[model samples]
Target: MTIEVYAMLKDYFEKQFIIKEQITDINSLKEYLSEQKPEATGILRSCRFAVDDEFVSDTYQLKENDSISIIPPSSGG
Candidate 1:
């Protein structure tokens, strides 16, 4: 199964990118993110997690071919 991963917060200062990962559950996704970008650890903790555009918590279960997005706090003047 494939999952679509999107990053929102990090895009402000870095290149925005998406990931197409073969994974089964949220835990695996977390592990994958940790490996791909260690710097995202802190942001992940505070960021809002979502599945298929619906807001969810870290423990939310992910299904096959699900779309997941991490949206970090946004600030502007």
Candidate 2:
């Protein structure tokens, strides 16, 4: 699976990465990423996930060719 991170997440992790582990859903992905960087767990827990440009639920199934975007909270005026 192709993982793309944005905002604060990019500061902590690579902008993009590929994972071969059997990650079946967004929730699992979150856990995996958190384990990779324990310090980012708080942000990762609040991050939103998108698949192919569409926001997805935690249970959303993942596909090998799918691009997963981890979008951190943002603020604008």
Candidate 3:
């Protein structure tokens, strides 16, 4: 399962560039993030998750070749 993470999530990932990863499910994805980037802790609390442009939750089941994105809160005028 290749997931496409967004750059806006860099804040939680130690400022690394957005990249794709192969994982099993959302749980594994969370674990992978925590391992590769400890800064991601608690970041997913208020984040919006999407799969293939559709909004989903962390418990959402992921499929092979799925594209996922984690978007943090933002403010604008």
Candidate 4:
């Protein structure tokens, strides 16, 4: 899977990267990411996910070669 991260998550991960783990759904992906970057656990848990530009839920199923985006909440003036 190709994961594209945004916002503060960029501080921890590259703009995009590939994961070979057999992650089946958004929920599991979150868990795996949190395990990889414990410091980003809270943000990962609250972040919104998008697959191929379409927003999905935690239960959303993931497919191999899919392009996934992890968007953390942001605040601006």
Candidate 5:
């Protein structure tokens, strides 16, 4: 699976990365990210996920080569 991260998330993993797995569900991906970057766990857990431009839930399944993006919440003046 290939994932693209934005904003602060890029600091945890590369701005874009590839995972060697046939299927990577949203929840598993979140767990892996939090494990790898403990510092970003809270933020990652609250963030929204999109695969191929459509938002999906934690149970959503992802196939290899799928393009995923993580969008964390934001606050601005």
Candidate 6:
């Protein structure tokens, strides 16, 4: 499935990629991402997952073509 991953910061990752393996839920997606990019694991764990603009949990079921985003905590000085 091809999931769109938008990062708040460009330095986090390559912006997006397609997953050849089946990703049934957010938890599985996270795990897959961690394996692909170990350096981002720490930051990724703290980020939030949103599917199609709606905030979702680890149990949220994902489907093909679902637009996903990795929203990190934000703060203003």
Candidates in order have lDDT scores of 0.62, 0.92, 0.65, 0.95, 0.88, 0.77
| Candidate 2 residue pairs in clash (backbone atoms < 3 Å) | none
Error of 4 at 63 (Å): 0.3
Model 6, 28: alpha-carbon shift in Å? 0.8
Better of 4 and 5 by lDDT: 4
Minimal lDDT window, size 10, model 2: 3-12
lDDT of 6 by residue, 1-77 (tens): 65555545347566676777778999998888888778778877888888878899999998977888877777789
- The order of the candidates by TM-score, greatest first, is 4, 2, 5, 6, 3, 1
Could you give candidate 5's per-residue lDDT for residues 1-77 as a string of tens digits? Answer: 77889998877779998878555699998988887799999999899999999999999988877889999999999
User: What TM-score, computed on C-alpha atoms, does each candidate reach?
Assistant: 0.61, 0.95, 0.65, 0.96, 0.88, 0.81
Question: Which wins on lDDT, candidate 3 or candidate 6?
Answer: 6
Per-prediction CA RMSD (Å): 4.0, 0.7, 3.6, 0.8, 1.4, 2.0
lDDT top scorer? 4
Note the residue pairs that clash in candidate 4.
none
Better of 5 and 6 by TM-score: 5
Regions of model 1 farther than 4 Å from truth:
1-8, 11-24
Model 3 C-alpha lDDT versus the unseen true structure: 0.65
What is candidate 4's TM-score against the reference?
Answer: 0.96
lDDT of 4 by residue, 12-37 (tens): 89999999999999999999999999
Question: For model 5, what is the error of residue 71's alpha carbon versus the real structure, in angstroms, after optimal superposition?
Answer: 0.6
Worst 10 residues of 1 by lDDT: 9-18
